[model samples]
Target: MTVVAADAAVSQVDAAAAAASTRPRCSTEDMLQLLQDYDCWVFDLDGTIWRGNEVIEGVLEALELLRKLGKKVLFMTNNSMKSRGSYLDKCLQVGLPAHVDDIYCSSYSAAAYLDSIGFDRSKKAYVVGERGIMQELAAVGIESFGGPDDNEKRASFSSEMLHDTQVGAVVCGVDPNLSYYKVQYASMCLLLNPGCLFIATNTDARGHFTPNLEWAGAGATVGAIKGVVERDPIVTGKPSPFLMQDIAAKHNVQPAKSIMVGDRLDTDILWGLNTGMATLLVMTGVTDEQLLVAQRGSSNGVKPHFVMDSFGDLRRVAQQALQQQK
Candidate 1:
């Protein structure tokens, strides 16, 4: 084939994808019927709720509809860079009525996991993330070292530097200020301490903001430590089931009666599958129809139970149900 022919073929594929995205997998009646089975709604924040600083269209209205229907709603995110309180603030800023109890983030889950294992003030954690990790750890009375402020401003470091043996755990997330010193110190703590714990918030290598844009995720920093220490860290975010464990114990979530709505198939859909809940994929944030089309016949990876053009359509479905009731 000629180069022009290849270009035309590529353009055709793009056009086909554009058309597929505007289509919905389930009818309004079917969606309402399916929603009746689930009492609790668990959502992913980034791609599912909002992208960057902009709230997705119809998300607030959809949430309102769910609330009016008496569904228990909770927000779950794998981005460990912010605390739950911070996330709650973002929700309110975006016109989503949210309570402090309604938000759950990977930082909170990581801290909760630490607290579950008898973590206390007596133990110390060396963290590679930002203030979010520190804030959560402090809430549980766990002391942490090597936060954003602890990072060295200068490149001066040597093996002669004193090592702190009190660090019983090394926790890592997305750290923009990640440096060789942070990696070296975390490696020292894990290497010197015979039973030191290594934990990660999420292993997502990259996050997709739009179909054509992407950004780094927590896995990048976590992988840096793994490269130096040659050991795998315990992941505490989606697909790990740690957050679901807490949600089940506290929120009384029944996996069969719950719905996990997200944009990323690997993290959100896979997480719901791992927890035995139905999953919904939305195209507002990441993972377009082209990718979903490829996974349609596969039995291996987690596939969403339903797919939609965007999260706002769920609100429209709910509105239709209300009209039917009227």
Candidate 2:
């Protein structure tokens, strides 16, 4: 080849190498390096770790390996139906290694948000959720009423109920026992009280309760209240920076040195991106390979830095790395 042609080819090769180095690693071949690169690993719970009541295969093993490697692990979930203590219990029940401090659920986030805002201690909150929300609120010394109790109190909407101005905030989450009365009370609390806060644990559209069905999630309840009140709620779950910022500050986690692994692009991946952390998309729950591929091809899509078929793959990668070292 001519000297000029050889020089041009070498330049092209160097340029390609530089471009490749700048791109995020997606291939499984780089999993070992990724495992070593991050100091902290943040995981999305529901889809990435477990679906319904069953734990995903190899998840426990992977978590054990991460702990062995001295990596800081934290579980973050948008499921506001349960408190952090309940989530810790679920993790222990499923044989997953976890600590209550390492778990951050939307239920806790909502309470923390209220605490951060200097909510009046004397005023009570009208809860349109499960016991989890109530538990977290109480833990922070915030009194709440109207969760399951309101479900059975399906009395006619009385204007007198709105006259009670003790309710300073209206907190909503996924409630299987949601009733019109609960909605009516929560809506009235927000409408009548001038400074009554409207807070939603999350706005997730669907939840996985059973293996075959998708149940209406907190968004359904949040939407119901939003539709009636004509006001946007302050969301405290995934894709919201409040929880992420709190975690970073409290845990001293550096975004650059942490990786967020989750199953959903919109919530999990988007949350990671919003918080300046590396993101890994796992196809174990709500997201599938087809959906991931389509998202990657979309012009304005949010893509993860890495993609794994399942979180279990991390266990396999760790095993392989260990074997290679031996």
Clashes of 2: 0
Model 1 worst lDDT window (10 residues):
1-10
lDDT of 2 by residue, 1-34 (tens): 0111212343455454334433433566778888
In candidate 2, which residue pairs get closer than 3 Å at backbone N, Cα or C atoms, i.e. clash? none
lDDT of 1 by residue, 90-194 (tens): 888888888887788888878989998886567799998888988998888889978797676434545365568989898888887888878878888999977
Clashes of each: 0, 0
**TM-score of model 2 (CA atoms):** 0.88
RMSD of each candidate relative to the true structure: 4.9, 9.7
Question: In candidate 2, which residue ranges exceed 4 Å CA deviation?
Answer: 1-26, 157-163, 323-326
Worst 10 residues of 2 by lDDT: 1-10
